[model samples]
Each structure stands twice: as C-alpha cells, then as structure tokens.
Target: MSSPIQRVRTCRDRGSPMMTGRTPRMVAVLGVLACAGCVDRRFIIESNVPNAQVYIDDQPVGAAPSHSSFEYYGNYTVTLVQPGYETLTKRVHVRAPWYAYPPFDFAAEVLWPFHIKDTRRYYFELHEATKTRTDDLLNSAEALRLRGQTLPAPERPALPKVKPGAAPIQPVAPDAQPFPQPGSGGILPPPRQDNPLPDVVPRVGP
Candidate 1:
C-alpha cells in the first residue's frame, strides 16, 4: 500500500494538482474575487446651483455635488430643487460598458487582470424663477367679460296665441255714445215744496 507522501507524489505525477482539497477552496475564492469586479458602477451628479437638494426616484440622496451608486443599467429619474429657482428634472440612462456586455463580459469578469471600475459624471444648469403672469391673465379675462356686457341683447319675435274655442265677433262701432263729464252741468236737481202745499189748502176752503 502506498503511504500518504507517496500518494501525494503520485497525484503530482498524474498532473492532477487541483484534485487536492485545499487547492479547490483556493480556486473558489479567487473566482469569487474576480467576479466581484464586475459590480455596478458609481455615478456623480452635479448642478450649477450650489447646495440644491437632489432626489432619485423620489428618494432623497443628497444636495448637489452628490454621489450615488446603481445596480441597474437603465433609465433613472433625477430631480433637483432649490430655493428661488425653478425645480428641474432629468432622465439619466446608465448604459453598460462595452466590456461588461455580451461575450466580452466573460473576459471582464474572469480574464481581466485588474479590478475594473466604471465611473460616470453628469452636470446640469439650474434656471432662476420668473414672475408669474396670473394677474395679467385675470385682467384680460375681466376685460373680455365687460366687453360682452356692453353688447346689445338680441330681440326675439313675439309668438301668436290660439284659443281652443272662440267666435269671430262683429267689429266695434265708431260713433258709440260717450260718458258725460262731471263739470258739464248735464244733470238736473229734484223740485222743492215752497208753493205746492199752500195752493191745496185754499181749494179745500172754497
């Protein structure tokens, strides 16, 4: 039977050194380290306005001149807000590096000699706020309303009415008698008893 030392020598002679227990562990560790270099990259964000607040996907990152890391290679929404300045939004696209894509990615993850890092920078200019024209718009609307009020209303024609049952009467007479006036003296007064009773008494005595 071969001893332990003799067995080790036989393994080397057969060119199977990787079959050793410790060598497999070492290779696994080295593979893990090599693949770690292909991790996502860091992106730098900056703006002309100093100390502006920054947000990514509605999550606050930091003020301007900030640093952020992403694990994706797609579109991202970035927002910048500052006092007395208009808020701004940006759509950032993080494309994978040429080496980190397709068949070449295999070389970058395993065959590349050094750790590869992808760093990107973005810059933006913030604009100042402007005066609002809401009052001017309201004034223009009021002027239009007053001009409408000054215009004459359109006249509508009167509609004729029809009764259910009505006779065709004669025409009115032109020479109809008129009512008497109060100050024209046309009304006479009743007679008084001044001489009527005296004449009746004389006839009775005869």
Candidate 2:
C-alpha cells in the first residue's frame, strides 16, 4: 500500500492544468489571429473603348473595367485591343501602401487584428486607327500614266560642242633667238645692222 503523502503527490502529478491541456489550440488560435492582417491590394483598369480586350504584361486579364490584385507594388504593362481601332499600350505604376513599408509591414503581417486592403482605379483613352491617303494618290497617278495623260518629256536642245581653248602665245623677249631648222647648219647667221634685200619687188600679176 502507498503512503498517504506519496498517493497525494501522484494525484497532483496526474491533474493537468488548463494552460498545458490547451497549448496546441491556443497556438493555432494565435497563429490565425496574427495572420488576419495579411491582405492583397487591388486596382481597376478601364478604357473608353468598349469591349476592348485588356492585357497586363502580355497576359490577357480581362476586358475594360477589369479588376486586378497584386501582392506588391510595381510597374505593369497594360495593352488594349479592339476592332477597327489602334492598339494602345501603356505603362502603369503602382505605389506601395504605407503598411507595406518596413516597420508598418511587420505590424501588418503579425500584429494587426484585421486585413488592410488598398484599391485604386485607372482610366485610359484609345485612339482610332487612321487610313493613309498614299495608296489612293498612287492609284490615281498610275491610271493617268496608263491613259497617256501624263506630262510629255520636254525636248532638250543639243548643247554646242566647245572647242578646247588654244594655248596662249608667249611673248618673245628682245634677247631671245629663234631655234635653227634641223637641216640648216647649227650656227646662226650674224646679225645685220640694216636690211640687204630690196624694199620693193615688182609683181607679175596686175
């Protein structure tokens, strides 16, 4: 038989307190409570072009008036497509909320009792596609050419042939002498003080 004191010690050891008995449940509840503030941010994208397909970062999200969610803030590419309209592309900048910053984010992730959500709306304008008049002008020009109504090529007068300019004659110096003929003796005749030939010669023809 056990002693009275020993029996009392055993009974006390067997009796579990509420704190130990509910430890797991209390932890789970605390975890759920701490995560309550974790939330996603959302934004709306709208365009004036009705029924235009919307795309974000090349992924088709929805049509105009689309609602999107993001976990963090950053830039995104938006594209709009519609029939008989110019495709529109633009860059969208989304800024982080106050709670997403360092110190605030810590509280928002762990301590806040409820989720905080941020929503923003954006609108865009799309322009219609325009037709170029170049093709019409070209077609008209080609039809005029085939009908021989085009302007005739103007006749160009023949340009006169320009003779090469004769080389300029150089002036003879007083002391310079003429070159001797090849057949004549190399020595030059002595200079005469006066003319030896007759001044006038009778002509045979009248």
Candidate 3:
C-alpha cells in the first residue's frame, strides 16, 4: 500500500511546476551556440634574435616573438622578420571563427613590379596618371594594340685605322705642280727635236 502511494506521488510530480523548469532548456541553448560558429585565430611570430620588427603592406604589425590575430573571416599577411635571415612571410586564410591554427612565426609579403612614369603632362591627359611621355599615358592593353612604324636601324660609321708613326692624311689637289727645289745647280736646257735642228743650221748627213 505504501509503494502504491509513492508511485502516485511520482506521477503527480510530472505535472508539477518544479518538474519542468529552465535548467534543461538552458543546457540545450548553450550546446547549440558552442557547436555552430566560426573558428578562432591565433598568430605567433618569432625570430632567431629577439625584438625583430614586423609589417603588413608597409603598415607595422608588431615586434618579433609577437602575437597578432584576426577574428573576422578573411585573408591576412603574417610577417616575421630577423636581422640576418631573409624576410619570411605567411599568408593566413582565416575562415569563420578565429581559433583554427596553433601559434607560429610568420612574415609579410614581397616586392611587386614597378612602373616608370613621366610626371609632366603630355599634349593630352585623359586622367591624372603621370604618363607624361607618349608611351607614358598608354596602358599595357592599349600600348600593345598601337600600330606604328618600326624604328630605323642605327647607323654605325666605320672607325678609321691609324698607321704606326704616320702623319695625319690631308687632301691633295688634282692639278698640283711640284715647286723647284732650293740648292739644286741644274739649269736644264730645252731639248731640240730632230726636225728643229734645221732652224739653226742645215746639217750634212754623214
């Protein structure tokens, strides 16, 4: 008879206010929150020597043996730097929650292509770009499509060879006459032709 009474009380207890309360409801709500969300992130930076500097896209991140992190879902650069070793960089892809990977040393990004620009304005400038020269204003895509004359080959004159112990050559005249040499004793007589001898005297043939 006592066991029957106890069972009845237990049955009535199911409908009681204390029997159905907020304890179970709170547990279930917390469980759902813990399971569904983005991961967390932690970044560790280090160097062989202590107190190395760090940077991101020319912006300073922190010092070496330093910790930096991001919570949002995106991409960020991790840069670790020391004096002696080359600059080391790591690209961290943070997805959802932040805490995904263990702490580690990392580095920033590297150099990109440089463009030479003319600062002055040309005859026309559609925009504020410093492409001052003719080629300066043109972009990669337009410059390729431009058709113009090919540049002429450069003319290279032949170099003159110098002779050993030789005086520099001078231009000579075509009808130049040789001058008489000083200190020469000869007054050269004019030669007479065979027929001209008759003008002086008629000669008898031997």
lDDT per residue, candidate 2, 1-206, as tens digits?
A: 99999999887877766557899998988888887867667868898987788888898878988988866689998899998888999998888878789898889878887877788788989898887689889988899888786668789999656558966556686766787999887888688656587788977996
TM-score winner between candidates 2 and 3: 2
lDDT of 3 by residue, 122-200 (tens): 1111122243375654665465555333445679999788799999788796654455567786464555455554446
Per-candidate TM vs. native?
Answer: 0.52, 0.58, 0.28
The alpha-carbon RMSD values of the candidates against the true structure, listed in the order shown, are 20.0, 14.5, 24.5
Q: Which candidate tops TM-score?
A: 2
Which prediction has more favorable lDDT, 2 or 3? 2
Q: What is the C-alpha lDDT profile of model 1 across 29-81, one tens digit per residue?
A: 88876876554578788999989998988888899899888776889899999
| Model 1 weakest 10-residue run by lDDT | 197-206
Candidate with the greatest lDDT versus the true structure:
2
- Candidate 1's C-alpha lDDT? 0.81
- The clash count of every prediction, one per candidate, is 0, 0, 19
Q: Sorted on TM-score, highest at the top, how do the candidates line up?
A: 2, 1, 3
